[model samples]
Target: MSTPADPGQAEPQFILYLDGEAYEEELRLLATWVHALLLPVYAREVTSAEPWCPRWWEHQEAIARLHGLWLAWQELTDPAAGPSGPALWHRDHLGAVMHELRSPSGPFAGCKQGSHRPKAVPVVEAF
Candidate 1:
């Protein structure tokens, strides 16, 4: 699975999840939001994990990929002119991602409990 390239094939300023006409833009937004929130809450744990830990390695890759997305996110939105556009787009995308996660019957169709990572097609290979 893969995220779509940014318009005109410019190095995708953001991570995108496009599935036919049903583009999963929310994964991209959650990618940004989770990008910001994960470091403080996630990186520390992954970094400190012992090699003996069961899922430490897998978690490590996931963390690193998220960080990469965050870095790109910062690049895409840091400019004075670009921030507003991406930020607003991200907000709407996040809402959409959440709606899908909470939907009655979808990939996230059934589970609507607490915070959950929506299904996404990784843009960068972590495995």
Candidate 2:
């Protein structure tokens, strides 16, 4: 068995884990809300001077923080070796969605092409 890590280490391991999970959850929620709730609304309004937008910048910073937290967690979890945490996070979150969308055509796909197929619906658009 591997020796346990030092709790007094600079990294709060649990915080890293939580941040990474939150990042993925938030991303999935955003994707779900956009795809399931939003509607395509066309508006004919164009001006050279859009209002001074600080919110967009704020959101970008938030996303960057999430990314940083995830990477930091990954580094802590496995120093020289790669951890499956991030990969599993992606597979459990985004990969599942994509898998539902893409059809498994390979014969050895383990099952005879299940009869269930999810609806291919485009639910969100932004101008």
lDDT scores in order: 0.39, 0.35
Instruction: Tell me which residue pairs clash in candidate 2.
Output: none
Question: How many steric clashes does model 1 contain?
Answer: 1
TM accuracy, model 2: 0.22
How many Å off is the CA of 110 in candidate 2?
A: 44
Best by the lDDT measure: 1
TM-score, every prediction: 0.30, 0.22
**What's model 2's lDDT at 11?**
43
lDDT for 3 in candidate 2 is 14
| lDDT for position 59 in model 1 | 35
Instruction: For candidate 1, give the lDDT.
Output: 0.39
Top-scoring candidate (TM-score): 1
Give a tens-digit lDDT track for model 2, residues 1-127.
1213434555432322444666466555443433343212211122222111112113332234433434343443564435675455454444333233222431112222222222234489897
